[model samples]
Target: MTRSEATASTTGTPEADEYDVIVIGAGPVGENVAERAHANGLSAVVVETELVGGECSYWACMPSKALLRPMAALADARRVEGASQAVRGSLDADAVLARRTAFTSDWQDGGQVDWLDSVAVDLRRGRARLDGPRRVKIEAPDGSTHTLTARHAVAVCTGSRAALPDLPGIEEARPWTSREATASKEVPGRLAVVGGGVVGAEMAVAWRALGAEVTMLVRGERLLPRMEPFAGELVAEALTEAGAEVRTGVSVESLRRPSTDRPVTLALSDGGQLEADEVLFATGRRPRTEDLGLETVGCEPGSWLTVDDTCRVKDVHGGWLYAVGDANGRALLTHQGKYQARIAGAAIGARAAGVPLLETDRWGAHAATADHEAVPQVVFTDPEAASVGLTAEDAERRGLRVRAVDLEMGEVAGAALYADGYRGRARMVVDLDREVLVGVTFVGPGVSELLHSATVAVAGEVPVERLWHAVPSYPTISEVWLRLLETYRG
Candidate 1:
């Protein structure tokens, strides 16, 4: 039978409104899972209460990048002598906000919904909860409810939400989460950003460029604490150079805003107080499983779902439940979540067809081994920070005998030509026992595009001798590879 015919035969049947796969959440991860299942001749339906494209499309990735790009472009131009002469004015905050809104399609999901229809993946606009094994109860926006049974699997991809601290008067103060930070139409004259992770650092760069006096108050000693120490140090130095305040080793004791018209007063942990027109609490994220009725399936509500490499939930019986993306807590990155979705969808399809899951081993078609070994990320600050796989500290902690090679990016002909006074660093950690790179980090302008090559090297575990044969074109930042190799040899 044709694919559509096969899907039609199994979906919305008269006996019971059932599908081969009932995917909870219509985010990118959930969408990929449903699409893959449908491609494998299984009928799939995705349920989402919010926008179909989810956080990345609206609040996190798309809008955030849209806001950051203009500033980065201007900075790039300022680094070049002739271009710097032409760049005269500050960023137009209104124009930047308009561009950001345009990227989000003004917060509408009609296009995403249309795409789902085109792919033959049914979409149910509602909040969904686990009824039991292979069963889901959906409550529609209009208050109607229905239960759908999954013939093969039910995958939860309901991402995460910003975790606000339990500070007194926080709710009344009305702090901004990532969503508000990215979506706000107006730039506050004075903005206080809490936390120093990717969201905190990037938003600080974005708003500060848009005419806000940005002050980053980090509880930790540095920004981007998860990456190499130098990465955070570089970002903090840049933020300070750009006139934003980077205050580390500080915490908010309490927050108070007497009225909507007034400013927020933050009582600091060091017995000091500061005020800001707006405060963004980019603290952390919490899973969206509290109301998903996980208790019905013997899983604790509001807890991260434990999943194997195949993205199958471990605690649930029958092997019919799957959780991908941030829900699984494997890797919170959007790309990594999509990767897990593809693997999980294939595993579900194979099991439904009574086929043996032969590719369940490491680095196999059904396994998400990259989550543990070669996750790649790029922080899009002024000088982008990109890294893949293990950091040197991570490799050492894992008991791997590794030698780290560091190189000044300015020494590269390409980097020098890319910008005047180009300041950046590159590092590669090699597994001495294996003679392969276990980690690679690049901190410089336009380094985001250089990440995939490192991702391939780490994921492929290509031998150092073979990498030497893969020549880098001269006068490019990629030539840093050759320099790193030379440094390693010396």
Candidate 2:
């Protein structure tokens, strides 16, 4: 049958309610899962309650980065000699918001929907939940309901939602989550950010540049508690230098907002009070599985699902239930989720064909080894911090014999030429037993582009001796690689 005919037969009628794959959520991860399953000769249908492109497209990644770019460009220019002299005015907040809206296509998902149609993957606009093993029930917006049975597998890709802290009068305060913080159209005069994670740090930087008096309240001793100590230190220092207050070891005990037009009053655990036009709680995220009908399949609702290397959920009796992306509680990054989806899709196809699962070993076509060994992340604060694989602390905790080598990025020629007074750091954690890079980190201007090479080294497990033969071009930040190698040798 033709692709369109196949899709119609699978989703057009109540009698024809079976597909090779039933994917819940239409975010990037779910889209990839459906597309890959269809490519592998399986009919697939995706169910979504929100935009097809999910959080990254409309709110988190794209819009947030768009809002950040203008400020970053201006900051980069001021770091140079001739450019600094030419730099004159502050950021255009309205223009920044417009550009951000443009990136999200003004919060419309038509383009994404069209792309799905072109791929011949069926789309159902609704909320989905597991009825039982391999069975999914969708509740459409117009109060219609339909049930779909997966001949092969059901994949859950519902990502995550912002988790708010339990404090007195928090709900009444109606504080901003990451969604509100990224999608806001206006710049608040005085913005108070609680939590010093990636969301908190990036929003503080973006809003401060957009002319807000930004204050950061951190419950921990420092920001980015999961990354290396210096990463948070550098970001905190930069935020402080940029006229934002970074208060560590403080928490919001309570919040009060008398009316919509009034500012928010926060009672602090340190026995102080502060007021701000808006308060953003970037505390954490919880899996979007609370109402996903996990209880029907012997799993708890609202809890993260555990999966194997091939993304198969362990709690389910049959191997037909899979959970990808944030729902699996693995790496939460969009890129990593898509990677898992690809592997999971292939595994489902191979099993249905009654063929041996292809190369189920580490780093194989059916394995998601990267989720554990070589996950990479980039935080886009000024002097962006990027890291791949493990951190020094992670390595030590894992009981690996490792040594961390560090170098001042300013000492590199390319860095000096890039910025007048370059201030950043680079570190590589070497596994002593294997003589390979177990982890790598770079914190400096324009270092986001340097992440792939680190990811390659860690994922490929390139030996230190072999790395010596791979030469770096002169007068580039990548030359920091040579410096790192030299430091490791010494």
Best-performing candidate as measured by lDDT: 1
Estimate the TM-score for candidate 2: 0.97
Task: Write the residue-wise lDDT of candidate 1 on 270-384 in tens digits.
Answer: 8888899999999999999999999999999998999998999997889999999999888999999999989998999899999999998889999999999999999999899
- Name the lDDT of candidate 2: 0.91
What is the lDDT of every predicted structure here?
Answer: 0.92, 0.91
Residue 35, candidate 2: C-alpha displacement in angstroms: 0.6
lDDT of 2 by residue, 67-169 (tens): 8889889989999999999999999899999999999999998889888888878888888989988899989888889888888899999999999989998
- Runs in model 2 lying further than 4 Å from the true structure: 1-15
For each candidate, how many residue pairs have backbone atoms clashing (under 3 Å)? 0, 0
lDDT at 144 for candidate 1?
89
